[model samples]
Target: MGTMAFGRSGASTAGWTRRRARFAGTAHWLLVPALAFTLALVVFPFGYTFWLSLNDYQFGHAARFNFGENYAALLHDAVFWQGLGTTFFLYFLSLALQLVLGTYVGLLLNRRLHGQTVARTILMSPFMMPSVVIGMMWLVILDPSLGAANYILSLLGLPPSQWLASPGLVVPVIALIDTWQWTPFVALIVVGGLQALPIEPFEAAFIDGATRWQAFRYVTLPMLRPTLLTAAILRSVDLLRFFDIIYITTQGGPGNASTTLNIYAYRRGFEFFDIGYASAIMIALMALVAIVVLALMRLRRSL
Candidate 1:
């Protein structure tokens, strides 16, 4: 009787296990349609872009597969090289300023100050504005004549300078405007990270007679590494492809002084009608951004 009961229990357990395996398999198969749709959306456009890059694709003209000629032309183009140089300079300069200014703002926002809510809302105004709008706003404010920026400078007994038109000032002014608009985004992220950090470390630091600066340097900074890297990654990707503000503000003026790779790509593809060459530039930029992002992602993971 005991053996018979044991054999019956084993048979029932096997049947239940098989039923669960079948249900799990069915659920996985049910996800196939959504996965396929997502891949189609992402993969098709990328594949088409890559295909266009290999050909002599002129607007409304026959496309001949030129293999690698487009890429070769890009390599030989001095204008393309100059645009790449400008992009790197804009990216690094804006990133450093944003991180520093953003961190400082974040620290201030993290404190319990009077009108904290109102202050945060006001700080977010610039970032909330559209890129084109921000560009236009700054253009008016920094106008060499009849603009508020020069007017303020004149009041301080300084000569009015061309903010956007001057070749030397265009890139730096653009960087400053970018910093003004986006610093709040970094600050908000850092503020949230600060709030989420455990209080134990901070309390212990105070008990150890550490000065506020020492506590920040030794404790807060170490703990905020991941958050800082996340902010960097977000800023880096957008800055690399930044176009609208620069386009609307300088339009790559003063003879390509502020022409970024994005603007150059736009000119090549649309303005100049060299779609194939433009596609090559886009692909190269995509690869460069991918490398930077992947490295940052890996670093984040390792940390």
Candidate 2:
């Protein structure tokens, strides 16, 4: 009777194991659709762009494989280098301004205040507007003559100066424009981070007689590194690929002062029809954005 019971138990365990294995195998099929979508949209486009980068193709002409000549030419292209420098300049400037202003605004919003809901909605209005609309709106407002910005300058008894028309000021002006539109986004992220943070550390700091700034700098800031880095990573990607507003306002002018890699690529591909070279420029920009995001991720991990 004991030997028969043991044989029956073994058979039951083996049957259950087989059933579990079959269920696991079936579960994997659920991922197939998502994988197919990613392959079709992301992988294919990237592979095709890379292939185009290696060729010397122009619009309305046959593609000629040139063994990386497009990239090689990019190495010696002065405009490309200049555009890269401008791109970084705008990227860093815009990012710094946005982070600082956004974090400050976020801190303000985190506190209990009257009319906080109304203020947040008003502040976020710019971010909700379409980029093209913002561009067109600013273009009108920043017009050197007969624009509100200059009119306000005149009201202050200060001489009105060119805002976007001046080459020296265009990049910084654009940076400020972007900061105006996007800082609220960073602030929103920061507010979320602040609300999620554990309160114990802040309480301890206060009990230890730490001032508000000290508490923020030493306690709050350290805890918020990951959140801040997340904001940085998101902003860095957008800033690097900045094109729409600049294109609408300056079109890579006043004389390439505000030209970024994205603008340059657009001109090359759409205007000049240098399809292959433009693809290479885009590939380079992608690499640049990837490197910065990865570095930020590493820093976040270290913190």
Candidate 3:
């Protein structure tokens, strides 16, 4: 009877082990569909784009493998260089304005003020608007002659200026417009960061007799690095790839003064039908965005 009982216990243990193994195998199989979807939707398109960039593929012509030639041409392309410069210029300018104004707005919003909720809701309106609609609206508002902006300038006894038509002012105007639209987004992020911060740090600073400005500069700013870095990374990606508003408003006009890499790539691929070269340009832009994002991520980690 004892030997029979021991044998039964060993058999039961073996059965349980087998069942656990089967369950684990089933769990792994459940992940296969998700993996397959990712490969099909994400990985495949990127691979195809990279492959296309290495060829001479035009819309109406036969594709020929001309690896490196497209990228090589970009080296000597004046328009490409100009677009790159314009892209960075607008990116930095917009980012700076957004961060400064956003931080200031965020600090104000953090305070317990009357109608604070109403103020935040009103401020977020621009960011919530569709980019194309904002572009069109601004286009009408910034018209040199008939626009409200010029009308306001005339009311102030200032000379009405060409807002978007002039090449020199177009990029800056677009940057300011973008700042106006997106500053609230950055401010929202900042407000969240401020709320999440520990109260102990501020309390300690005050106890140490630190002035308001000093405490903010030394304590609040240091603690806010990660939050600011997060905001910077988000904005950097959008600014680098900015397209919709620019395409709608300026169309990279006034002799390509506002042309960014996105606009340049669009013109090459759709308008000129240089699909391979356009692919190369897009790849370059992707690489640039990746580099900047990666750098920001590294800084975030350090913080």
Predicted model with the maximum TM-score: 2
Which candidate would rank higher by lDDT, 1 or 3? Answer: 3
Cα deviation of 301, candidate 1, in Å: 1.1
Instruction: List ranges where model 2 is wrong by over 4 Å.
Output: 1-16
The C-alpha TM-scores of every prediction are: 0.93, 0.94, 0.92
> Which candidate would rank higher by TM-score, 1 or 2?
2
| Tens digit of per-residue lDDT, candidate 2, span 1-303 | 787888988898899899989988887897889999999999999999999999999999999999999999999999999999999999999999999999999999999999999999999999999999999999999999768999999989999989999999999999999999999999999999999999999999999999999999999898888999999999998999999999999999998898999999999999999999999999999999999999999998888
Clash numbers, per candidate: 0, 0, 0
**Where does candidate 3 have its weakest 10-residue lDDT segment?**
220-229
Candidate 3 off by > 4 Å: 1-24
Error of 3 at 3 (Å): 20
As for TM-score, the candidate ahead, 1 or 3, is: 1
What are the per-residue Cα lDDT tens digits for candidate 3 across 55-103?
9999999999997799999999999999999999999999999999999
Model 1 segments more than 4 A misplaced: 1-17
Q: Tell me model 3's lDDT, rounded to 2 decimals.
A: 0.94
Positional deviation of residue 86's Cα in model 3 after best superposition, in angstroms: 0.8
Model 3: pairs clashing at backbone N, Cα or C within 3 Å: none
